[model samples]
Target chain A: MVPISYYLILAAVLFSIGVLSFLLKRNVVTVFMSIELMLNAVNLTFVAFAHRWQAVSPQAVSGQIFVFFVMVVAAAEAAVGLAIIISIFRTRQTLNIDQINLMKN
Target chain B: MQLALFIIFAALAVAGALNFLLQRHPINSALSLVVVMLSLAVLYWSLGAEFLAAAQVIVYSGAVMVLFVFVVMLLNAGEEERTTGSRAAYFAGIPGAAAVFCLLSFVFLSESKTLGSSNLGGYLNDGTVNIVEISKILFTRLLLPFEVTSILILVAILGAVVLARKEPDPKVVTSSTDAAGVIVIKEKV
Candidate 1:
């Protein structure tokens, strides 16, 4: 059996990678992707804990339920997020996050 | 057996990430992310999170990724010009990545020591876990978050619609049907 710790560690690593990517990448779309990666990492950890504890004593399905909800939010986020990205491109002719300096000042 | 499957899924996820990082085209990166999501689904399945695995595939691979791809296509995001930051900033990422790895290792080691093996009650009853029991506990305990999630989805939809709406031309909307139609204005090349 693969230990639950393994999954948790993997999730943490993936989340960190996502964070790093989000920081390093200058493209708006890539940053959006990095955010998705971070969310998925959280879902992985949630499911890992749920699987581990659910077998022993049936306390609650908190983790699994959380994952479900996160997925729902992610879907809605993607829908609106991409639409906005397209609109931004239409207006600015650029998809670079760095070029979005108007919001900074 | 299970460990092998876990390793395979992990490899797939990592590979997808690597590909996404290196790929030039935005659309390709979006597609690779879909692969990563599928591998996560498999991982969830192996962990006995059947419902979660299914939802992962359906919600992520099916819905979110498609939207991502659509945006990539619609924006026509090409290779971006790489701006070299200062040498200090470039080198800083190395230590940052290492620090993150160490933190993850520490958490995993500590958690493994504290978590004890619990008896697999009804999950092992019929060689498959009961989905009903899972839902019951979810609805009962995590009901508030569940409702909030729905609201969040609604907000995302509304935000996307609002953001994507073009600056309406007063002359363009002559009718109700035209009002609903989105005018795709071509950026002056």
Candidate 2:
């Protein structure tokens, strides 16, 4: 049996990596990917906790259900976000986040 | 056996995430993300969330990643240029991430005894099938949110279509108007 802490620690590591990439990366798409990674990390944590509590109560499956909703939201976000990225690229002709400062005047 | 599988897939997931960060091209990063998602799906399976494991693979690795790759190819995005970047991000971001990791690790480790342990496919011993148990709750307790997500998907589709459509060229519109004006002038003459 793996300690629940191990799963949580892995999730924490993944999330930190996501944050690092989100901060350091210049490309908008890659930053978006990092956000997805963060969401994935959170989903992992939810599943881990759900598994941990499954022995206690049947309602613990709600964690997995929450993950379902998270995935749904992620799918919607990806669709809309990539479309927004496409439009941004169409107008700016660049994907670098630093150069995208039209409103920074 | 379960511990070995968890360690292997966890390593794969971390490696994929690091590759995602290191890649110079968006396409490479996107592919690395797919690897991470797949490995996470395996982890989900190990955790006994069978339906979630399948959904993770199908929706995340399959659908969302395909969307990312399509956009990357459509835009023909080139390699990311290495910029010196802002001093603040360099000074703050790495430390911030490290701090967050340390904080989470400390908390989780401290609570490990209370949080307990999990076995691979441990939930299967309960005799209820995983998918059925999930659906029973999902359709009953979680039905409202389920319906809401359908609406959310619909809105996303509409937004994507509207946002990604090419703007009508102002130059083409002006030229068409100019042509119409010339025809009107010639008719009058």
Question: Once superposed on the true structure, which residue ranges of model 2 sit more than 4 Å away at CA?
Answer: B171-189
lDDT of 2: 0.91
Q: After superposition, how far is residue B120 of candidate 2 from its true place, in Å?
A: 1.6
Alpha carbon lDDT at A98, candidate 2: 86
lDDT of model 2, residue A90: 92
Model 1 Cα lDDT, one tens digit per residue, A15-103:
87776776677789988998999899889988888877677755446677778777887788778778878887877888887676667
TM-score (C-alpha) between model 2 and the true structure? 0.92
Q: Write the residue-wise lDDT of candidate 2 on B1-189 in tens digits.
A: 888998999999999999999999999999999999999999999999999999999999999999999999999999998886677888998999999999999999999999988877856675777889889988897789889889999999999999999987654222223644763222221
- Tens-place lDDT digits, model 2, residues A1-105: 999999999999999999999998999999999999999999999999999888787546888888999999999999999999999999999999989889988
Task: For model 2, state the Cα shift of residue B117 in Å.
Answer: 0.9
| Candidate 1 wrong stretches, greater than 4 Å | B85-94, B116-124, B127-130, B170-189
Ten-residue stretch with the least lDDT total in model 1 chain A: A53-62
